[model samples]
Target: MAQKIIGMLGGMSWKSSAEYYRLVNEGVRDRLGGLHSAQCLMWSFDFDDIAVLQREDRWNDAADLMVEAAQRLERGGADFLIICTNTMHKAYDRLRAAVDLPLLHIADPTAERIKADGHKRVGLLGTAFTMEQDFYKGRLADLHGLDVIVPDATDRATVHRIIYDELVQGKVEAASRDAYRAVIGRLVAAGAEAIILGCTEIMLLVGPEDSPVPLYDTTGLHAAAAVELALG
Candidate 1:
């Protein structure tokens, strides 16, 4: 069987993008044994530029940028696309329309895993845009039949701050990890059966041990799904 090339639209932080690259390659090697690696292409962005657009709430501009990147991947002969950030999936519809390749949405595999685990209610932790917007959580609810919950406004702000101020910059302080553990506690109190580390960078901060319930890392799940499609 021939492997399909995975196109990664990344560099929303480059830190998490690096994880995606590692996880995808590791997945392929695990599936195919020694000396195997993923067939993949990547077009990374200057995250600073995207950050400015996100802060200004210029979603259309962000969408345009995403479309441009997806087109580049298509022209480079990518078989499918994976936008590496959960927040940027706000522009997913535009990217999907602009490109010929199938886009592997970050939320789909997360939702699927949550459902497969028999979890109907889950908590989400991500950038403010992903948490507060309709693009990600809405899709989980509307398309996947899962009930998604987010942190309160204050916790949401903390999650957003930690992502931009520390995680994205590759800073992983124990204080931030403790803060996230507290947040996860609250979500579990609120009847969340599982937690979705909705931001790719979040896997850097907390994991299953940090929570009483299950923790789903979108980067790992998304990359694993990409490998499946590439190898299947």
Candidate 2:
């Protein structure tokens, strides 16, 4: 079978986008063996401009940018689209409306993983918008029948701050890791069966060891799912 070309709409921060590229290529090689790599096209953005729109509450503007990128990927011969960042998924509906290609939403695979593991309740750690808004958590609850929990307001701020201020820039501090561990601990205490590193960048800061329960890395799951679709 001919491999489908995966369309990657990324660079909400290039750090996580790089991980997606590596993981997709590695997945293809591991499955198809020796020298095989993902058939993919990437349209990376200048996230600084995207961030400015986000901060200014110009979501429509941000969505416009996403639409433009997705359209570019479609024209470039991509069979489907994957938006690499969790937060940017807030604009998902708009992008979907604007593009003709199928979109592999980042949340669906993560929710499936959690359910497959027999987890009904999971904690999410991501940018403030993902946690506070309905776009992501609502999708888990509405579409997947999963109970999603997030840290308290204070911890949410900490998570959001570290994402934009540190992780996105490729800075990973032990102190930030420790802070995340503490947040994960609290979420577990609050009856979280597992933790979802909902932000792509959060996986860079914390992992399974930091949480008492299982840790789901959205970035990894999303990439693997893309590979499955591309090669299936």
Candidate 3:
């Protein structure tokens, strides 16, 4: 059997999408020897438009846009799909229904790692939409049986602002990093055993060394999973 082609719908910020591309191809190369990389197709979106729809609570429209993107990937001969953003997965059902190709959920790989590590509770850090919404936390709790904690309202606002104003723009500041550590501290105080870097762009700001507990980089995990599926 031929290796499956991985399809990604990304560029929600381009910051994390760039990481996904590098990680996916790197994973393939590491496993398959020199010169081998993922046979991948990517559909990058305009983050400006998606952000406007999200800000206005027009997820139906956002979902419609993703569905169209997924169809294009499918037509381009993609065997499986990856949404590439945690917040965007809010439209998972709609996007999945519109395409026949298997769509990998970013949460699944994170949950799998958490479960394997015997962590019953975890903290989640991501965009306000991903943190505040049930699409992500609910999936971890309901589907994977993990307790999830998010930053409080104030901290959530700080995190969200840092993501858009700093991280997505490719700017990393010491103060912003400190702010993230403080929020992670709060989650740790709330009994979180591990932390999920739910936003792909988040790993840029906070990483394993920054956290007291184990840090799960969702982008790396998701990309690794895509490589596994592609190789098989």
What clash pairs does model 1 have? none
Report the lDDT tens digits of candidate 1 across residue range 87-199: 99999889888988899898999898889899999999999999999889899999999889999999999999999999999999999999999999999999999999999
Q: Score each candidate by Cα lDDT.
A: 0.94, 0.94, 0.92
Tens-place lDDT per residue, model 3, 47-164, is 9989999999999999999999999999999999999898999999998889998999999998999999999989999999999989989999999999999989999999999988
User: Any idea what lDDT model 3 has?
Assistant: 0.92
Residues 1-232, model 2: lDDT tens digits: 5899999998989999999999999999999997899999999999999999999999999999999989999999999999999999998999888988899999999999899999999999999999999999999999999999999999999999999999999999999999999999999999999999999998888877888899999999999999999999
TM-score of each: 0.99, 0.99, 0.98
| lDDT computed for candidate 1 | 0.94
The superposed Cα distance between candidate 3 and the true structure at residue 28, in angstroms, equals 0.5
Each candidate's number of clashing pairs is 0, 0, 0
Candidate 3 segments exceeding 4 Å error: none
**Per TM-score, what order, best first?**
2, 1, 3
